[model samples]
Target: MTAAPTPPSPPPRRDAGRPRGATIVAAVLAAVRAELAETGFEGLSVERVARRAEVNKTSVYRRWPTREALVAAAMEGLLEEFGASPDTGSLRGDLHALAAPIAELAARPDGVALLRAALATTAPGDVRGAARQRVGPPVASASSIVDRARARGEWRDGADPQQAVFTLVGAIVHRTLLEHADPTGEWLDGLVDLVHRGVSADPPP
Candidate 1:
């Protein structure tokens, strides 16, 4: 029998190569990250970020009213898009799962760069506030997981779901962004252990 014709190659992705919104965001973020890694906060500026993103000054300014706003928007987008939520059955497992990407991001070049930039500024305001608020959805999503666990009696009725989410995120932020230290899985596990000790009730024999 004649050999079957080879299947046609898949169509190239249309959006993959374009300079669309995602591209703009990615380019600006990468540029900002690079600058932050090199110069820390003093180096980050609207003009610099715009040049790096390869977009005009108008585009950057229109989207972000200020330097802080730009930085916050970039950070919020990065965290929302790349970070995974905790969902394993046990709290420890869920925490570990959440921490894995965080540890990896903390150790990444871009992540280090972004952290440096974020540290230089006071808390975000105005446009920055809007961007920071974007975190609400993901934060709520993470909280729901913990709440479900609590409902199942896997966790104590008094468990603070919000605290659990923050603790997990904060550990990674502290190690990678603030301390400028490489985040290790062991370190993440330590964080989980600490939270567990604080929150978990002793299981009956």
Candidate 2:
């Protein structure tokens, strides 16, 4: 007589074999950032990304379908993160809030590497454009920040919003990469103060 074998555990249910969507997306996006940080867009390899993500290449392809898509997905969170200005009720406080995160990122090894990678290229293609496409144009957020400051009588007469943001970004880059300095409390506070003076209603002497 033969014994029953539990029918193979009901074939493990229909969708059990499918990869978890959230987990898979997170892994793929993280892998995308890592690959982009290391190789920029030109050197990005699907195989390497898949290997790093611990996912099948098919999974990445099926979801993203292209390097641009992967980069876009990877940068989505950053889009939201750097897009909003906190209303701390003061221009100086708002500027500090805005610049704090970026400066903090520059202080980290992985972050500084990624920051360098962000400008590693200037060509038409590569991660440079993809990054710009995703993270920018940051003008909207900057404009809103300045507008708020203006309403509070804190904005300078002719200060450019884009230029203000650029200055902050440049200072952070120079401090972290060229100067090899930590963008810590005192340094960040000084940075905010400097930019605030430039962006405030006082003329430079």
Q: Which candidate is the best by lDDT?
A: 2
**1-205 in candidate 2: lDDT tens per residue?**
8887765554332124675788888877877777765666667788898888877788889998886667656765654456577788988988888788778766765455456446666323554554555435344568778888989888988888889888887888889877989987898899889999887886436
Off by over 4 Å in 1: 1-26, 40-42, 46-73, 82-86, 113-124, 127-131, 134-138
TM-score of each: 0.64, 0.69
All candidates: CA RMSD in angstroms?
10.1, 6.3
Any residue pairs clashing in model 2, and if so which? Answer: none
Query: Distance from true position, residue 1, model 1, in Å?
Result: 69
lDDT for each residue of candidate 1 in 3-76, tens digit (9 for 90 to 100)? 99999996543224565677776677677666766666566677777776677777777667777666666565
lDDT of 1: 0.65
**Number of clashes found in candidate 2:** 0
